[model samples]
Target: MKTVVIGFLGSILDSGGGPGRWEKWRPSVSICQHDDLVIDRFEMLHSRGHIRLAEQLRTDIASVSPETKVNLHVCDPANPWDFQEVYGCLHEFARQYPFDLERERYLIHITTGTHVAQICMFLLTEARYFPAVLLQTSPPRKQGSGDAGAYSLIDLDLSRYNQIGARFAREKQESTEFLKSGIKTRNAAFNQMIARIERVAVRSKAPLMLNGPTGAGKSTLARRIYELKKSRHQIQGEFVEVNCATLRGDAALSTLFGHVKGAFTGALSDRAGLLRKAHGGVVFLDEIGELGIDEQTMLLKAIEEKRFSPMGSDKEVESDFQLIAGTNRDLRLAVAEGKFRDDLLARINLWVFELPALRDRREDVEPNIDYELDRFARDNDVTVRFNAEARKEYQRFATSPAAVWSGNFRELSASIMRMATLAEGGRITTDVVEDEIERLQSTWRPKPSQSNLESLLPAKALAEIDLFDRLQLDVVIEMCRSCATMAEAGRKLFAASRTRRRAVNDSDRLKKYLARFNLDWAALKH
Candidate 1:
């Protein structure tokens, strides 16, 4: 690891910036060139006299490892000249190491002076600046009669953007990973579903609709269909996702079908809608049940004709977008209730696949957790290994009622992160797992005065209250919890509803209940 000191020249203004200063005048801190190395900022920099600080750092590193290189590359504190000098020093430093243009190298900026140093260093390094990691350590602070203390460190790995983007695509099933995994790995009953989809997709006859519970991974499976159609079959198309809940009325229409200049207040220029952008690709409308009646009618026509006019323009614009929609609501119920278009439902119901939640596939949790743990560990630059105890704790959480994982894989991954952070001696124990569960359970549990059955009823309607009412009610009451909203009760109750069959047609009912209850059944189940 290369260590370059970009800012060591401290003035009275730089050293002390508090309301009043006594011996706490010269507060000093240090940043590690890499994440693993821990620096004793208070003792090494603050406690020691200014003249010996850098010398002390050199000595300390030498004591740890004689071969470590600690280079002192100073930058002026004023003007563009300072940045120019820093770049020159960095270039000189780069000369010592063999240059491989394709591979990424670290550019550690130790300056807290300005973002200018970072930006300049990045631009100077060019393509050679591989895997850039940025960390900003807070200026050290000194308290009464003691040395400086440093905390509130912010470290960001900028190189992970590409990887994160790829992961999102893969997790969303917009990549070939889905096809490689084989459709059989999906819900057992849906084995023939892929073949059925292939026929409809090939003919370009029907708009595809996927129905499942929230955590059932409908969006992910939709990406799989898109990937299969575009990548595997070599179909010419793009895959785009538009959450229907985010689009309301006018925005929904403009988003689906392009808008012309001056069409709306914000329309400064002509813009192609999601449909046009997805012309040769697949356009995925998530939470399709959230689409308004007018939007539904417009979408219905587009799906049938594969053409749509922009919001303001009178001329019809042609788009050959494969419509793939996903919803946790039942379109049948939605149509009957006059919320969703029956004609649109009829157009897209040809190939529907319901995804199985994570709890339903309990067998996958162990491997999935292990997979996520490795991912977190790798991202964190920690050589993390889960012991048998930790694995058992994970399994326990995996199987428990509390771990119903209504949010499916996403929630499970988050829980794993929490548990991993709390584990002792790198071993996750039952205590750690129980602590996490207790933390969640405590917040939702109710008190004695609030434990009446009437209180258990959902605020929206009494019918919406689940069977877990009394059990959770008592769970809350025993914990001396008082007064709870239907939303809170609903979250705790639905958190474990891994087996409840999601209604297919009750869009309004589900939305009202879910919104009022603030219950994300899919997130819990997943």
Candidate 2:
């Protein structure tokens, strides 16, 4: 195999004066003189003005190693220090050059070139634009001994170094584990999702949207992402978390974008809001779908421009913060209903990750149980463990379809805490497990309205309808059953919409909706 060394001409170093130039070591010439490190070919890059120096260096290389071939190429950038121009010139050179990876090994000489040019070479090689290792040359310690300069090859490919590769693999694994809260989850999809989330959290500063049911750890994961990025020195400010569902009207705007003195009825003083507090860090907007349309518009602007005016303020305040929005509600559906702004959704939907509900990841329940117990021990400073039979019994029910886990990890954590608190002598037995199971089942049991719907609708019909639709239908039916007339029920149901419309035909609209379910008011009331 042939050896190829590609590098810039060291104009100052290679121009070894007149006849006495041979005494000093030149990188380009010394590279070819090393007997063991043979350079079959040298592709020397230089600016057009350095053509004369390049020719002289090539001749000197030929003098030392007659077997080596020297080729010169012009790579002139307007400014040697301009990153873009230098990188472009080198990038184009690498793109046009014919590299025979199978027959020749390539080395990028980083010893000769401006710092920017060296950085570009490293980046190009690292990105595999040049399939080569970096060659760094240094002057010998005994400079006057006529010793050839020392040279070292740095291979960017981590796979070549087992220890370094293992270290990176370990670090990545630790990051995934950290994101998972150290739970040894068995769900393949959940594990894969965490891996991807870790990669994105580290590499990107764009807004991330976590879509999942309430209590599915969206907030927890968002916090973890903030902490992870903070640990990496990617963020410096505080992690500001706001539950958008709890914010309303003027208060929502004030809380998010701040408020000047006398902004509203209760504005006693000026206030800097959550977004400002999160500047240079992260802002997690939990239940973002619940934010009012007006607030959504302002939020969209803040996210895009990183600047927004506080209430009653003419000036805009800057808050450069990374955003991570969480929502259990389907924002797309909310948009269709005019509850959510589509543009806001579009901006935040760039990196959306849907967290699977606990029931969907039943295999992970056992690991989470352990995690919760460990957390309990840490928080309460009391060690608690379930007896063998009790642990088996809980695991069986936890992973079973019977366990709704409606509140996801939150519910599981609560259950573990309860059991840990009730455990006798730090041991949770079968009786404790059975009692916890009963409590969980009662908590998840269908409500009276849901039970009524089950009896009124056919089993097959109920199965065919989505849970969301079923719940809505159940409420509409209950409303009809309580009202004396169809119009009465329609008026109550459509009361909110009535105020907005000129001609409110509430009965007609209610009739159409009921017809879709193949039912009328008379049949529903009965």
Candidate 3:
């Protein structure tokens, strides 16, 4: 197999000892004569302004070894220092070059080009825009007979060098930090999860499922994934997002699969739908568990087949796209209850990730507060600063056990927005923080009945639940209190769901629900 070298033609005019010196010492020719290296072919790129020197150098290089094939390309950039123009020119030049990695080993000669051009080559090769190793040539320090300048092949994969690898590890950390909205989280588990998600976003096109409660930043993360992919050129089309929960019946069908004119009662004109518009890119179906059964069925076909018939149309339209589905609901439960398709669940079930709710990740709240304030300032064109006391007070309450961030980051973000809005003279004083705290307290505080119910439980049981769990338990206990028997309570709580439930065990179901809180039906009702 032959090796191919790609590089620029260094000007022969720079060689000092007249024409013969040019023949003997042209760097392009010297590059070919490196004793340890064998020349197969050189894809030499030079500007049109240096055509004569390029041709002369090409001939001199060819004279060194007749077997070597030198293909010269005329690549010119208006301003070499301009990264955009230089990269663009080289990119076009590379597109024209025949690159066959299977049959030919490739090397990029980095010694002769301008620094900007060299950087562009490195960037392209690093990106696999040009898949090749770098070859750097150097002149001998002292004049010696039969001694030639050195050549060494450099691999920029970073894995080959400990220092470079460690540097890249830092880069990966920065990438993760970017995804986290600059939050320097102390949670090792959360950071590891973000790293995994980062790889999936950059490498895979398979459907991804993000399962988490609302305000857990699933949608925000989805948008971030799309942006990262776009910046990496992994995806080309626009990010089309849809809240499946907002769609219902015919609207859902038409909104997703699109519709031809007169497809339905309101179909006065043709619609392309969100899925078709997301061609060659990403489609984020948030709250996917809320999609109707029919829409789920159609979506499954589109995902598996990459083609689907539009509403009222026989012909199928193709949309090559990646899928990202997010839901706060338990889709497995929905599938079991026949509210969602099990097969669709299995398809997207391949890459399932759960984003932790904000309250559970309280350690992240402080940094997120700063992030939200920055965002609010950017959006509203107002610079709001929290005074030292206000900042300390807010952080104390936000992280305290008494804080019931039931709405998670969404609620937290709103609280910050409210404080920033009401802050006098762009300063969030302690008074503003107190007002926000009072507002949150009013919102999250349990009703008297719920508090009374908590008192009825054993101290050990009370210790088992924080605010959120107690809120849910309180609702269940209220139902139990209203019913005559445990079976009646289960019937009322489960409602018409029993028809879809696989096994009819109302008493057992209620018994297990009560057990979760360390309470029994007899203890609760009697």
For each candidate in the order shown, give its overall lDDT on alpha carbons: 0.57, 0.88, 0.82
lDDT of 2: 0.88
TM-score (C-alpha) between model 3 and the true structure = 0.62
Minimal lDDT window, size 10, model 2: 479-488
lDDT of 3 by residue, 1-526 (tens): 7888899877642233345554343456776676567788888888888777777666766777676788878888898688999999999877777788789988898888788998999999888788789988777665433345678888877556898778878987777777887877767778888999988878899999887767778888888888888888988998999999899989999999999999999899999988999998999999898898889989999999999999999989999889999987656646655788889999999998877767668888888888888999999999998999999999999999888676788889999999999988999999889988998999876676646455687767688779887878878886675443456568778888898988898878878877776776545543
TM-score of 1: 0.50
Tens digits of per-residue lDDT, candidate 2, 1-526, equal: 9999999999887776687887787888889977689999999999999998998988888888998999999999999999999999999999999999999999999998889999999999999999999998888887656778788999998767899879999999999999988899999998999999999999999999998777889989999999999899999999999999899999999999999999899999999999999999999999898898889989999999999999999999999999999976656646765778988888999998878778778988888888888998999899999999999999999999788787888999899999999999999999999999999999977675646568677888878889999889888986675453456678889989889998988778898998887776556644
For 1-526, candidate 1 gives per-residue lDDT tens digits of 3422233323332344333443342322334422454432211211123444455445544554454455433333335346676566455544554544354334334343345555655564444442333334444454554333343422344364788767865654433335324322444444445445555554664577876556556676677777666654645777899999899867888988889999989999998988888887888999898899988887877877878789899889888778888876656656766778888888888777655556566766666666767876877766445667656765776776665465676677777788777666666776776677776456445455654444544546545667676455445332222111223333444455523647422333334554454443232221
In order, how many clashes per candidate? 31, 0, 0
Clashing pairs in 3: none
Stretches off by above 4 angstroms in model 2 are 1-4, 15-25, 32-43, 58-71, 77-107, 119-133, 141-147, 155-159, 446-526
Write down the RMSD of all candidates, one decimal each.
24.2, 8.9, 13.4
What's the lDDT of the predicted structure labeled candidate 3? 0.82
| Candidate with the greatest TM-score versus the true structure | 2
Which runs in model 1 stand beyond 4 Å of their true positions? 1-187, 190-205, 377-383, 420-432, 439-526
Who wins the lDDT comparison? 2
